[model samples]
Target: MTAVEPAGLAAFLAEHPPFEALGPEALDEIAHDAHVERFDDAALIHDGFKEPTDEVFVVVAGQVAVLWNDSRQASSDPDDILGPGDVFGFRAMLTGRSLGPRAVACGAATVARIPASLAGPAFATRSGARFLVETMVPDRRATDVPSYSSVDDLIEREPLLVDPDTTVGEVARWMTDRGVPAVVDLGGGRFGLITDAVLRARVLVDGRSASTPAREIMDTTAPVVHLDDTAAEALMLLLERDAEFLLVTDRAGVLRGVVCPRDFAISPITVGVSLHEQLRRATSIEELATFAGRVPPMLGDLLSRGLGAGRVIAVYSGFLDTIIRRAIGLVFARHPELSVDAFTWLSLGSNGRREAVLSSDVDSAVAFDDAVDAETVPAYRAAFAEVSGVLATAGLSADGHGTTAQAAMFSRTNADWRAAARQWLAAPADHNGAMMTSLLVDGRPIHGDPGLPAVSRVFNDLREHPGTMRLLLRESLAYRAKLRSAWFPARRQETFDIKTHGLLPVVNVARWAALSVGSAVLPTTERLRAASGSAMLPADSAATLIEVFDVLQRLRLRYQIRQYGAGEQPTDVVTLKWLSPLDRSVIAQAVREISAVQRRMDNVSNYVAVEEWASPGRA
Candidate 1:
């Protein structure tokens, strides 16, 4: 559908409440970018469960019916109905979810589809903010994370299903023939999985006859994932469950297909099949390093997909985590005597929060069992040395704060971690206690165990203790963006510390809200959006801060991508003149939103950290 005359579209949009608040330029941009489409009475405008929408629709003629239950319905039975000048699909754009009040044409309807790229200014409008505040629902998730592709999209072929009595040799032959995942049919809709590894382990290693029943050797406890689950979610599920592959099933428990990490090529980062497989199969540190060079292109592709900044950050951080994990595995493979089961590798700071950027430092820590004494410590250190070398070669920088395993303070026994957590929570104002506490609060298990219970307990203590949380909040206030008019300029050749001013404030406050409310969710966007009705942060402020966070993240990521492409160190410094006028304007608005939140925080507490720099400059 090609775009027609913009004058009519612009006029139609101007009558809508949110678009009415947008200026003529913004409205015209949307109009110019829009393509008109006509739908029949029952045509689906959007599928509410697949992925978020990239475009919003405005009804121009006839009627559009909304089905909040996400099921198609007759025009008369719709949850809500809209006529000419009515808008739909903006909520999906804002929330980045397909939780739709599904739209269906009540009759022959004409609608203008405006892509987010063009209608962004409308999303930044005051009326737009008000609309979100009023209509926005506090969305909770099973995991506080994000994704791009689903398991259904990854399933390459149908599963090779064999009867329960089928011999191991027969199953092996079938698997070899189809190159598809093999499953044993156990009747009653239950399934057991078999693989080449299963054949080797059960039949060969155990010296069992190839005539044994496939069902007996099949893995009955094989992991499973829903067809709708994002590839990122499936990847994490695989790690958490220590499963080789997952049985992709529909809602009714029917096995649709089977998927593995290799099948999940499109994580938030677009690590295609070849690159992901290369990372998995690489035997040398140098090879892993070479493959790491290819990932920036994946990151660039992810940004090109128009996913939310938080999702992009999560994807980038996930890629780093997998690289580090693979590097660890490779190092350990050379040393068969070393057992890595008793230890956990953790990601800290921004990476831990799943909010990392291109140039994020390697903020990592290790927690090991106390049983590994002086004798075993040397071996662990030698192995970590190789891990660090691989990481550096892979372009990950060591943390300036010495938060890596190279630092004595960070690499400690599980018992020692518990003790440190107690100290930080007891006297958070002490030397580097605040910093350590914040890192621990944001710490995520990258490899090994999902988490070290000792480290997790530290966060539990922090959450239970309000005084410590308030102290952390006060410390967060130290990170401020300069929003004053005197220091601000439009389209100037100056750099803005987007991380400090634009990002950190929102990140910090959201952290405060998460901790204060005792919600353990990571990701700044999740924290802010989840803090919906709290008095300190009202629904509107939370919504506003979310928008601000997204804008800052978009600018910072685009800037870093440009810098990375130029073969320079990727930094969070966003150059104003390099940005489009709209981007620069959004940054200004985001800064003001952050400032407003900071002002509210000021009224919430007068107690400040003892550090001189942590003190505030009056707003």
Candidate 2:
């Protein structure tokens, strides 16, 4: 392999964005020191398992494939490929992180590597920097996903709300009592946070009298967080505002309490362990049911605190997975004669994708090892029935649409599952094949061996079946227009099915795009993120869908939490009257973007990439 003679390196840089913005001198400097390396065969270039690298590489010719894993191992599989002029490693370099993904040369290739010490200045240019951020980094990688814990959970005491006209002397006395006076409730929901620092600045330095009204000398610009706001959110707000304390309020905007950075609870891991221990000790279906009942309130609290819906969904799924694993153990104990020992219980659909809401239906299947013969299939049916029966008894209704593990169609031997997957992939439109194939596309194991060969393969079994993926996308368009038609009429009403319109289309589009590129990533947010990197959909299109998905999840969770609080059954069909004006506008904007994604998904070329999945190059 040798470097491309297409043009001098500087000329190439002068044509590309970011590099082009670097000006002629910087480009020459970058080109002069840039070292070219060639690979006659695929070789590991940068290992995520190794020490961190402080340089970036651009594909001079052929391709460099990216793979993510903890251990340094060579593989033919590439999560994504960087072709000629495409850059890699800057995201890690700029962020001061390890590579996090292994980069391997694909076949005979030429690559130019440049140290950050040289290329850093070029990337610092306004346009150049924007390119590195907006283009170089996958949007998901940049996400600062805040961890969970609400102000209500963190606050040590109730707030002391004083009259705005309280004497400065009394306020000063409260400051002596603690470090700040009780807050001045400025009526109409605003607050004046008075601290010792405020006393020093406004009274001592400014020569104000102690007899002045408390409100006059008080500092009113401290950051405010809802009592339900996550500790991480509060901390971010405080840091962003350079505040010493946060004024906490209830959902109705009434002042409730206060918290400082030191008030945060560092106890999630402790809480998780405590809960897992409880699940482990749950020996009866009744006991398991009791533990499962706590999930709704836990999730409600998380949502109430403004935790991201995606994170809440993951937490909720984890709760279910724990309960289900215990349920499996109980099944074996009750029916000790069952022959099926090696098996995997699969969570499908919304649950599988970790996009489940408080009201989302449960769907699942089970795969027994191939050694379990046809004679044992009937014997294992009761075991299958028991698993679903336990979950249903614990309030997780099996809405698998006749595809539950209890059915013969779903509970199958390993060989049978793979064979069925292949058949569905081959003819997706026949005999409800599309529906079955779609169900397994996002299959994930919650119990037993996730690597049970055929069971695990079902997750990405549709990767090579681009035609089936296209057919699935084309078929979705059949009834999509009708969903959008109802969406407008339901705006600002008591409620409408936002799930059918706002959520499903985004999920379907991400699903189609993800499977088309062989990505087995589960969550809808991440699916869209992966789709962008794969070029299965335009980055902006994927980003719009991601934003829309997040908004819909948050709205859905909040709506369901209210319903549950009122002793009503949780549902996605929720009222808009309860939403704040800003929230209503946000939902409206989300719907508009969802519609835009709908238009993009309708195009044949959008989901199905015609180019080689990981080819030598693409300009």
Candidate 3:
């Protein structure tokens, strides 16, 4: 190969697959031995009888058609066509057999030929082998086990069927006789599911007559999944629909059985279902705290089982939400004078977004109804304080910034919350205003009325205010310092703040874009999607941002899990030595992408002029 030819070959190979797994040094070695050959239409690049089958051909340009000759039949039709970035003739070269197919260019084309001796060893590397297996081979056994096994595997007994008109007494007796936890109600060509929990909560607790019809208690809207559906699909349905039991059906829409939370309890993360039940049944704060303690171990188990970081965070967040709500209930039980409808408990920051990890602190607030008089204020505050203390015992640390109900700013009336939001919107760049705006925008109700429509109206008003939007955009792009330092290993030599450098940039950008487009979506992923749909951000950029966010989130969780396992306090600052080369590369790429997003936002001249407020000296 000529000196220039090797560089050209390396450049072409870089654009193709399998070679991406190889480093620059390996590619340079292969490029040194590679030779280019040109072929015309109907010209054979290789013939089994004449040429030695020692080269693996990668199409550089145009296309090559592979035709096989057989004793039964021979045709002009090509068995397969290889194009740019596509590899061919490797199987024959690897097996030490004559080429079985004749390769002919469909048109004038260039092909890069590298000796199998060089290609084979490169492909033997772990990354290279994975690329080959993923791209070429179709291994049936590899796909036999899905990320989530089939739901049919969870069904240990046949489903019990009952008519809608059946007496509640008879239905209960039948369920007892069949040894099933639930029964499928089949009546009027429709299916409904009735579970023991529903029976207990609705019929028995409500003191309904035993002779009452079963149809009254049956949940007609219970989610149904096909028997062929995977357990992951069922779990998602359960979460999405907030249902305890899902009716299983066949293609014909006939009820097969019912899948409950216990079915999913087989997975380590899903064990939270049992813990959730216990939390709900607990009468005291200590019992609820004990159940909450199981979350970290469950989180570690899920991570070990190869669950994605996003899903694990979501599961952990669910457990925390359950603990917080149950603690509130226990507090209300102790007080009794405090009305449940009088106030709404708010979850802020990561917890509010449902993106919290094990180390996340408690950032919460309470918005009480204005109807509550001064006499009831003390009682309400006392109740919230008790709940906050229980949450602290349950592993959620109190927010040092005073965002929780333990502080006066967080525990406020509905009118006060509205007033505070207006003040922040008016002067968003003021002391603590920017942070408050970001947190409040992401605030979601955990217990009681959400009052979202009213809160959403406030956000809509802010979206229409150009000055507020400009301040938000400015604050969102203020992470340039962090991004610049993220590129150098020496800068992050001993420790790196994943949240400040890796996560917050993406979070801030997503929030700014979503709020700019008048979306009230809280989660980073969902915000990006909504922004993409609104054309506030491009679809491809939004997708890439989500991908980068996932990478950052995974790195943070993996580091924290290790810290937890080692009996060390989990912190946002991760040691550089703990990261693999791939992890560092992923983090670098994420930081660069976040910086790109920030730069793009900065260049948008269409936004409202912020010369007065967003001057050089401003934050």
Candidate 4:
């Protein structure tokens, strides 16, 4: 027996699966304990039920055959063949099963033997453990659904429509006769949707006559979806706009049938129509609270049904937004003096990015018109307070960092917001400034003015300052501590906080890249897409980040759902024991990729800084 050179062994291990996933420190540990051995052709490396199985073997240079003694046919055929980078002999050890497989060298073979003590900690690097599990059970793959891939698949028939000259009474009569709740207005080369709610709010509630023109009350700004667009795209449009109907058109711009929430409500897990209808009909905070309680169960259902994490979060965020809007509407009804048009309510953080999980709190702010007088500010504050109380009752707490609309700091006029933005930009490294920039960078107006010009202005102004980008990058790096080193040992007693260690770092990176490129997009995936398209980040890097983000989010959601079902308060921490070996492996790969992306970003930033210093006037 000969001890292998640690450096050579480390290099060999770094090129293989599971070991390749380990950090340098873990590889060093393996290199320290590993020993090299050579076997002659037809020599038995291990005999079934006789030889000790405490050591895991990795083929270095030649092939070895793993033969099961229980079955004569298997002995003849061999269960598996191990070549360079292949590992073996750990399954029986981990599971406390008898050594049933015998390994034989096919020819002159070199192998590295790692003690169970060293090989055991390698499982802490999820990729290593997952590889073992996968080798043991090859049939356990993620289930696939026969989902509708395109919006055109959801199109059933042509939409009901009327000419511009049609009277409201006639349109109402036609809607009733056709058993439809809405109709498309294809008049004057424009596409519009006239819904029952629109008719009631604009015509009936406003005391307009039924004989008035339907076109006058129709919603002209209905979101449009292309025929080739995926069902997810159509659903996103409906959810984002809070629109009941989406006008579907072909690439030629010809009118296709309309898509309602019901059309895309094929997933029993999402139940989009049922949830939206209930939210729309709810008239009070208490009523909305009842619906809010359904979200956790719905999330559980979605994950159980194998829905993608991106879709689950988007659907949940949309539902949560609907609840928020309905609750706001109820407040407005109670306090008519508080004008909705005067203030824009922005959802910050996860809600802003539309990436909220079940455990998320309400992170929001209010931006008011400059015309709002000092006397009216208190009234607006009171209204926001009431809204926050309702949301709190409905299960969403005011953000722990104090970014909610309940605070006077977050509730400010457009002029005040701009001033705050400038001040924060000046000290981006400060705790409060970093927190504010992270939140406001993803601020999306959920209620009132959808355009959110004031919030947009703040982000645009921050992006204009190169120093702001530098500080943002620094802020993002602050969370780099969450990333686990390859050599870090896994904990058995404590659970890992996935939200903190997994999701936020990716979110912050995407946010910085997006803002540096002047992209005002909110969602993490969209931000990466925009940044990649603008060449602020490499396309491959952006794509990898997106994939890793998706993996982290999915694991987070699934873990939370399981915790919630166990009568526990759903928290961000996930017990590693609860995860399948495959899931753990996937998560490890994702985390490593994220760290790599961060390093790439650091390199790019440093290079740019050097170039700028060398050529001070160059763009």
Highest TM-score scorer: 4
Best by lDDT: 1
Query: What TM-score goes with each of the models?
Result: 0.59, 0.54, 0.59, 0.61
Better of 1 and 3 by lDDT: 1
The global C-alpha lDDT for each of the candidates, from Candidate 1 onward, is 0.72, 0.69, 0.71, 0.71
Q: Over the stretch 1-619, how does candidate 4's per-residue lDDT look in tens digits?
A: 5556899899999988767866798788898888788899988887645565777788987899876544443436776778988877665454345544578899888888888777765643435423432353211111122332467776776677787768888888888777554555564446767877788899989998988887788888888888876565465556556566788878667777776654542211124434555675687778899987887787766555555667778878877788788878888788888788888888888988888887898888888888888898888788877888888888878877677786887888888887778788877766488777777778888887766536555666555567767767878867761434452346433356777777788888888777766677788987888777433467787898888888788888888888888988888877776887787667677778877777776776776762232122222
User: Distance from true position, residue 481, model 4, in Å?
Assistant: 5.9
Scored against the true structure, residue 432 in model 3 reaches a CA lDDT of 69
> Model 3 over residues 355-438: C-alpha lDDT tens digits?
999779988888888887868787787777888888888877878877887577777778877877887788887756777788
TM-score of 3: 0.59
Please provide, for model 1 over 464-549, each residue's C-alpha lDDT reduced to its tens digit, 9 standing for 90 to 100.
Answer: 56677678877888888665454345525476788877787788888777766567788887787666666566778788888878
For each of the candidates, the C-alpha root-mean-square deviation to the true structure, in angstroms, is: 20.8, 29.1, 23.8, 24.8
lDDT of 2 at 293: 77
**Model 3, CA-based lDDT:** 0.71
Candidate 2 residue pairs in backbone clash? 228-305, 494-575
Residue 350 CA error for candidate 4 (Å)?
0.4
Off by over 4 Å in 4: 1-150, 156-220, 225-245, 249-270, 304-306, 426-431, 461-463, 481-493, 533-536, 610-619
- Which of candidates 1 and 4 is the stronger one according to lDDT? 1
